[model samples]
Target chain A: MEYIFHITILISIYGILALAQNLVMGSAGLLTIAGAAFYGIGAYTAAILATAFGFNIFTTLIIAPIVAGLIALGIGISFARFRDDYFLLATLGFLMIFNTVVRNWENVTGGSFGIAGIPKPHIFSLTFDTPFSFLVLALIVLFIVIGICYFISRSSFGRVLNAIREDEDALKIFGYKTSTYKLMVFVIGAMLSSLGGVLLASYITFIDANLFTVNESILLWAMIILGGIAKNRGALLGALLLITIPEALRFFGFPNEIAGLMRQCIYGLLLVFLMLYRPKGILGQYKL
Target chain B: MKNILETKELIKSFGGVHAVDHLSVNIQEGQITGLVGPNGSGKTTLINLLSGFSLHDGGSVFFGGAERKKITPWENQIYNITRTFQQIKLFDQMSVLDNILVIITERNPFLALFERHSKYHISQAEDILKQVDLFEKRFHNAGELSYGQKKLLEIGRVLAMDTKIILFDEPFAGLFPEIIKKIENIIKALKQEGKTIVLVEHNMNIIRNLCDHLIVMDAGKLLAEGHPEKVLTERVVLEAYLGE
Candidate 1:
């Protein structure tokens, strides 16, 4: 039961990340790969604040996303002119820069060793210290993220975002400042992904630079692609399946030494088959 | 008739070649003005300049009798000027209704995030779809429409903007005669509603049947301008543009 709760907590955290990413990648047609960078920013922010200043989880939660959002605003403005592959490349560069900073900034980020002794979330008398309780907190955050994605997907703002994906120049001709919309969604997605980071840091009660690498960003992308892009349920479904699949591989009795390698092989093969047969994803309405 | 849009010595160039060279033209209010020229004659470039899709290299544009220094496509729409592309450009992935809704919905991003499409907005979009005879395909993706239907949807989008001056670049190109007739009626209706129109086309029959005023160009310069019948009969226009 504890193990099940652990898996569920991880799924919920990733579910938040995937939904936020869908706003940029699916709705706006921006192929950003810097999700993990924002996630790291949030995690590091929460870790440092809670440890150094003895701030509570509630305070860190609010501050972390704001920190990530401000950074995203700067990046979005600087990279506003890039489109398609260039945008993707720019985001990948940002991810590398972030990774370098966290790994090398010894005093603040603790270099490669990273911060430790992070506290679990608590609200006055209540504490989310156990796996089940943490799972409950993660689920609540995931639901809030889901609600935001759903609201944006149904509004007029979402209509413009869909139009931006389809044809940005056409939308501009109709009097939309496409750049502003792009920047807004980028910041919003960053802030939400940061929320996921905060939860991960607090739940693990430890922090390390290795946890928020570019590979983790790629995993988030795979979740959205495998589950479906643009659909909220698809994002959640993706988070659920991708998290469970590797764990399920553990039960197959593969050699412990080759288990990690075999998991990678299976993941690669599944994605290949998905791309070949279901290019739009399992429930996707739009193709990248 | 008053000039709704006037360009004074407008110039746009690409590398060494001039696409619109010191071109000056007038668009009369509440009239259909045809821009007829051969290929490479800068008709579309001129439309691009007027609609703020491209910037001028030199000279000034006057809208509502006020000289404008700078403009963007969105700013132009806010100034009550809009356009349709020669190639149909709709939100292909969106529903036909959404193509219109996007234009008619809130312009404010914050308000738009929380506000659902009001009854008036949906009804307005429905009216536009009905106008273009695409009401049956309201829920269909814009990309799934036939070429003629796409053209009509583009026009429907223009109508949804509710702008005063509209520039159309080869709207009748690659369209069937029946679709052409539908577009002609829509343009005529727009004119009747007091909208100023500038049309670019290669079809002489369309120019003769629909245009109240005409401007002819050759090599980025105005060759002739006046009543359609008068300009079409000019010896220079016939020899240079009509191949007579």
Candidate 2:
């Protein structure tokens, strides 16, 4: 039961990240590999603030996304200069830069040894110290994030984004500053990814630079691709499917060492197959 | 009538060859002006330059009264100048209603974040779609529309923009005769509404019937400009079209 609860918490967390990725990749038509980087930033910011300054865990949760957002705003401004495929490459470069900082900045990130003994989440009289309780906390945050995403996708802003994804020149001819729209969504995506990071740091009660690697970023992308893009409901569905597939793999009784490798292999193969055969994803209306 | 648009020595070039060289013209308000030229005669290039899709090497373009410098397509919005592409450029992923609704939405980012399509905007979109005879396909994806319908949708987008000066780069090319007639009616109606129109067309019959004034170009320079009835019969205009 505890193990089942543990998996549920992970889905809730990954579901948030998938929604963030969907905002840019699905809605805005930008394929970026920066999810894991922003996730790491959120975790590290919260971890440092909590351990060093003794800030409340819930307070850091609020601050984590904002800190990551401010950073993304700066990075996203520069990113606006790159278009289409070049933008994807630039994001990959940014992911590497963030990874390197976390690995080498030992004074803050603890340099791969990772920051351990982090406390679980607590909200005033409530404590999310147990797996079941943590799942509840994560779910509350998830619903809030989902609601926000739904509003964004349905609003007039979303229509413009859809227009942009189709024909930027046509949208611009009508007088929309496409770059500003792109930047706003990119930063918003960063903020949402950071929300997932905060939950993950608190849930695991540990932190590490290695947790946020290119492979993790690809995994998030694979989730959105498998589930669908442009819709938060698709994001949630994808996170659920991806989170269970690995655990389902564990049940296959594969060799201990090969099990982890096999799951990654399956993820990689699925991404390629889906991209070639079903670029729109299972529930998506638009192709990446 | 005052000129709503003016180009002073507007110049553009591709590689070493000039596409538009020392080309100057004035477009009067409330007039349907035709821009007719042979292939590679720089008619489309002139529209691109005026609409801020291409940068001129050495020249100035004046819209209304202010000089526009180093403008991009989106910036042309402020000058109330809009255009359609020779190649159709509609949002294929969006519904016909959304194609117009997006333009109808407020340009202010904060306001648009929460803004829904008001009944007024929807009715306006419906009216414009009706003008293009596309009200029934308002919910259809633009990509799925027929080629002629797609052209009408593009024109519908321009209507949604509600700009003062519209530069059309062959809006009639590749469309059916009926669709062309509908567009002709729309253009004529827009003229009645006091909009300035610059049309680039290859159809001489439509040019003769629709254009109030005609401007002819050959190898990047103005060949003729006068009343269509008079300009269409010029010996140079005949040679420019027939290559005598």
Candidate 3:
């Protein structure tokens, strides 16, 4: 029962990551690699606040995503002018810078040893101490986030984002500010990624820079890409399948090292194949 | 009547090669002014400067008695000046209806997301679509349309803007005869509604039929400007075309 609970939590966390990545890659047509950086910021903020500052888990949850969002806003303004490959490079640079900050910030972040012993979330008398109880909590948050994402995707602003992806100049002629919309999506994506980080930190009761490394960022992308992009359900499905693949491989007699490498290889191959054969993905309505 | 748009000594150069060299013209309100030039002539460049698509190195654009120092594309929308690209610029992935509807709202950062377009806006879009005879294909994606239909849809989008001035940059290029007639009627209707229009075209018959006045440019310089009949007969105008 605890194992099922943990798997469910894993799915919801990754589902958030996948959806956030989709906002940049799919919705806004930006190829960003800074998801893990924001994720790390989220984890650190929540961890430090909850542990050293003696703040409530709920307060840290609110504070963490906001910090991540502000960080995204700063970098996004500088990089938003860049289109296509340049934007990708800018985001990758941000990701590297963020990872370096986490690795080198020994005093605050606890260095490579990481921060642990994070208390479980509490709502008055109710405490999420066990994996099962936390799973239920994560699932509820996941539903609310997914609903907001859905509302955003179907909204008029969502249509404009999709339109800008198709032809940005067209949006401009109609008096739309394309850059403003792009920046909004970038920051929102960062907030979502950071929220995913907070969940992960609370679930494992640990925070480490290694967990939010570039590899994990790419893994997040893989999950979003595999599930298909631009569609909410596809993002959810992609996260579940990609997250489960490695564990399922372990059960089939593959060693951990080979399993990890193969998962990445399959993900790379799938991304390339999808770009060539079906750029739209399974549930995506628009083709880039 | 006072000129709605005027370019003073407008100059644009590409790598030291002048595309529109010291050329000037006035776009009057409620008139269909036709611009004719041979291939490589500065017709499109002139339109680009006027519409704020490209910057002019040395020039002043006056609209509503106010001189604009620099014309940015976004400013064009605010001033109600819209243009159809030489190549159609409709959102190819959007449905034909959305191509027109996307522009009808306040494109504010947050409002763009949640603001539902007014019913009147949709009705206006439908009317514009009907004017272009594309009402039936409103639900179809723009990329799926024929080339000429794409041209019509772009014009329809501009129509939906309710702009006072409209510029058609070679809108009839490669269009079928029937499509051309439909576009002609639409332009004629716009003219009847007292809106200003500037058209760039290569077809002499269409220009002669539709243009109220004719202006000619050759190698970035104004060759002649007058009534179409008189301008076409000018020795300088004929020489510019023949020389090219």
Candidate 4:
């Protein structure tokens, strides 16, 4: 029962991250691997504030997104000069730089050792000490993110993003400096992903550099692409599938020695099979 | 009475061949100017340079009769100088109404964050769609439109920009004659409203019938310039097209 709640919480947290990923890749037509970096930024920012400055989870929840947003703004503005693959490369650069900071900044981030014993979230007299309570909190955040994504997908700003995705040059000639829009939305996606990061550290009660890396970024991309792109419901379905399928394999109770390896092989195979058969995934509209 | 746009010795080249060599021309405000030339004579190149899609190797484009400055393609969105491509470019993923509505967006990106298209914007879109005969298909995805419909939608997008100077690059090339007639009326209406248009076309009939002034080019140099009827009759133009 507790295990099911834990999986539900994981889905809710990652569901938000996948939605953030969808905003950049699915709507804005940007393929990036930098989401993990901002996610880490949010986690570490929360971790540092909680342990060092004695800030509570709620305070860090609000502050961490802003911190991550600021970092993305600086990086996004500088990298906005690059387009297509170069922009993708720049996102990779940001990922590496962020990972290095978390790993080497031993005093602040605890370096490779990581910050552990992250305090679970609490508001007023209510405490999210159990998996079920935290799942409720996580669901609230997920719904908020969903509402915002729904609003964005229907708004005029969303249409502009759709335009940016389909025909950037046409949008530019019509008097919109597309690079500026790209930067703005990149920052917004980063901020939203950071919220997921905040939910992550508090729920897992542990933090580390290894948890946020380029590999994890790729995993998030796979989630969105597998479920779908541009659609918020796709984000939910993606997070559910990617989170539960591996845990379901564990229910088989395979040998501990080969279990991890076998799980990885099956997971990789599933992605390949999905790509071959349902290239658009279950709900994806975009191929990439 | 004053020239709205003047190019002084504008030069562009590809590898070693000059595409537009020391070319100079002036366009009066509130009139339709026809730019005609044989293939590769640089009509499209001039449009590119003026609209900031491509940079010229040398010379300057003096607009509003003064202030010679370098034109940056990305930053020229505010210049109200816009163009349509030789090949029609529209936001194919958006609805035809959205294709027009996106440009009519609030200049303020902040306000546009949550703003749905207001009644004013919708009505404006409707007006342009009706003008281009795409009102019936406003909700359809632009990519699903027929080729002729795509051209009309592209022109509608240009109209939505409300730009002072519109560069139409071969807008009528692949259009059906019936659609061409519609575009002809639209152009005539634009001219009547005093919007300056530089039409790059290969159709001599369009040039002769619609253009108030005409400039002809050959091998990256001006071959003739005057009223359309007089310029089309030039022996040099006939030879430029037919070859000596």
Clashing pairs in 2: none
- Interface RMSD over true interface Cα atoms for each candidate: 1.0, 1.1, 1.7, 2.1
Q: How much lDDT does each candidate structure score? A: 0.90, 0.88, 0.84, 0.85
- The digit string of per-residue lDDT tens for model 3 on B1-244 reads 6689888898999997899988888888899999999888899898888777788999788887689998877777777798889977778877898888877666776876676667887798898888888999999999999999999998888888889999899999998899999899989999999899999999989989999888899889988998888888888887877452
Candidate 3 residue lDDT tens string, A1-288: 777788889999989888888877777777888888888888888888888888877787789889998988999898877988898888888888877777788888888888998778898999988888898888887887897788778777877877778888756766676888899999988998888888888888898888887787787776666667677888898888877876688888988899988888877887788778877776666655
Candidate 4 — which residues are off by over 4 angstroms? A255-280, A286-288, B73-77
**How should the candidates be ordered by lDDT, best one leading?**
1, 2, 4, 3
Per-residue accuracy of model 2 over B194-227 as CA lDDT, tens digit each: 8999999999889888888999999999999999
Interface RMSD of 4: 2.1
- Candidate 1 local Cα displacement, residue B160, angstroms: 0.8
Sort candidate 4 into its docking category: medium
lDDT of 4 by residue, A149-239 (tens): 8888888888888888988877777767678778888988999999999889988878999999887787787787778777778878988
Q: Supply fnat for every model shown.
A: 0.78, 0.78, 0.58, 0.64
Which parts of model 1 have CA positions greater than 4 angstroms off?
A: none
- Leading candidate by DockQ: 2
Residue B23, candidate 1: alpha-carbon lDDT: 91
Candidate 2 wrongly placed segments (more than 4 Å): none
Candidate 3 positional error at B4, Å: 0.7
Q: Put down candidate 1 lDDT per residue, A1-288, tens digits, no spaces.
A: 999999999999999999999999989899999999999999999999999999998788899999999999999999999999999999999999999999999999999999999999889899999999999999999989999999999999988888899998878877888898899999999999999999999999888888888788878888888888777888888889988988887798877668877666766776788789886778887777
lDDT of 2 by residue, A179-264 (tens): 88888888889998998998898888899988999998999898888888777777888899988988888788887688889879
lDDT, candidate 3, at B211? 92
TM-score of 3: 0.96
